[model samples]
Target: MKLGISSASVTERYGYDKGFELIKKSGFDAVDVGLEQYGVESDPFKLYHRSEDEFCTFFDTIRKLAEKWELEISQTHGRCNTYSMDKEHNAYVRWVSERDLKATSLLGAPACVIHAIVSGRFPEHYQNLEFMISKNAEMYGDLAPFAEKNNVKIAIETSGRAMVNGREIKGCFSDAPVFQKMFEAVDTRCKTVCVDTGHTNEAVPFGAPKVQELIRLLGKEITILHLHDNNGTYDQHLPPIRPSRGTVEWCEVFETLDEIGYSGVYNFELNLIQFGGVMDEAVRFLGKYLRYFIENKGKLM
Candidate 1:
């Protein structure tokens, strides 16, 4: 797999230009442009409303810089939900989601990562798993045409089922079975899965499949990745922890990807530079390591 990093790694530190430049200098092959910088949800839509011309210019600038650095924008991420009950808010979120797809196209990325959008806090809403799956399919079906038009695919991400206010509630498509059903419901040509390692760690104890197992289960349907580490509780988004530093079994993860013939990018979604190290060396090390892992499949780290 090609090694890449998210632009979000340095957005707060250097803004877009310098941030992207740093990613390139660090030897990453691609980037994940996080449109959430504009705003998390309805805010991106609001930003565009405030100045459509400026919004377009911002992405234009990003594309030019990525070209300058020879870095590909492999994927993009922003917030959108299909299960919300509020009609007006849902409409606004949908608008932002479309803009995210357009932004992915603008950057020449092939996919855009999205959440399944069901909150664990609301048990009443998700009593029927079929309903939740159908909602996701319906929403992605609406988005697929635009995705195809933009030459992009919707990468549904696996997230953690959370405990809200002492209630153990299920998250949207947090498990392999539900995700498989959802995938079957949607137009597969325009959609795929982007597994978040950290989130997967959190989901395992809740009956969700292990990271490698999920990879083995989904196989080619898993087209993208969001690499990071967490402490087995929340989505910490920490830099890749030492193999012994966390719950994830890195060697097994690589083994499964190899077994399934994953030919995609090993895109790190963590804080690449701020975690205290030489940026270039850090990136080069990660790239080299991933290459080694791919070359030596099933060999334990």
Candidate 2:
């Protein structure tokens, strides 16, 4: 597996250039850019708002950084779930999708990852959910030709929430059935899935085997893998820990990847909230963990 790290880990301190440099220095082969999370006021709980010029400048900076570091721009991520169920929010989602896809294409990234839908009220509001899916497809469809022209795929991330009885069912949306349905409805070579291990830990109960099964079910449609570990409670975005019952096995994960013939980047997706000021130290820890895995992956395979 080619190793990578997400830009979200160092968005506060390094910005784009230093973040890319740190990723490269840490022995990562690629970097996943969290486009909407950083450099914009597009937090999930906040209003979706950002200037086009700002995003353009962000894209330009990333492109230059990628060139300078000889790093592959693995994917671009957007915050689609931040939008509320309104016409204006829907328009904003469309605009962000188009802009992110264009930027991904320009940067020669293979895929762009975004949430499938907002978590809390989706199950209670079936009509709105259906409308959102259809609208998302239509909006994404508008970019199909452009995606074809630019050679970038749009990937819907598996979410970590479930809706039941007008409330979240803790962990539900990231299940294989849900992902299968999303892929079926949004079927296209340019549209795919990005399996986030942390989200999967929150949503699915079957551990690493389940993750492998989902990848198998998704088949070649699985384009990217977000390689963060969780402790089966919250999305702890921590480094890979020892696996337990109903938890993912890092070694087994690498084995499964080899068995499935996965050649994409295995991106580390940690959050700095828990790591605190020891971001570099945390990265080094993760780097050592990854190096151990890489050196031992052949045995596992």
* Tens digits of lDDT, candidate 2, 45-106: 33224465665665677788888988888887865553445768766666666666777876
The reply for model 1, stretches above 4 Å from the true place, is 39-46, 50-52, 80-82, 119-121, 169-172, 272-301
TM-score of 1: 0.86
Give Cα distance to truth, residue 60, candidate 2, Å.
2.5
Candidate No. with top lDDT:
1
lDDT of 1 by residue, 174-276 (tens): 7777778888888658788898888888777777788888778888888899977777767777665355356776778887887888888888787565555
**Cα lDDT of model 1 overall?**
0.74
Runs in model 2 deviating more than 4 A are 38-58, 80-84, 118-121, 126-139, 142-146, 163-166, 170-172, 206-209, 243-246, 297-301
Which pairs of residues collide in model 1?
none
Best candidate per TM-score, number? Answer: 1
- C-alpha lDDT (0 to 100) for residue 119 of candidate 2: 46
Error of 2 at 148 (Å): 3.3
Collision count of model 1: 0
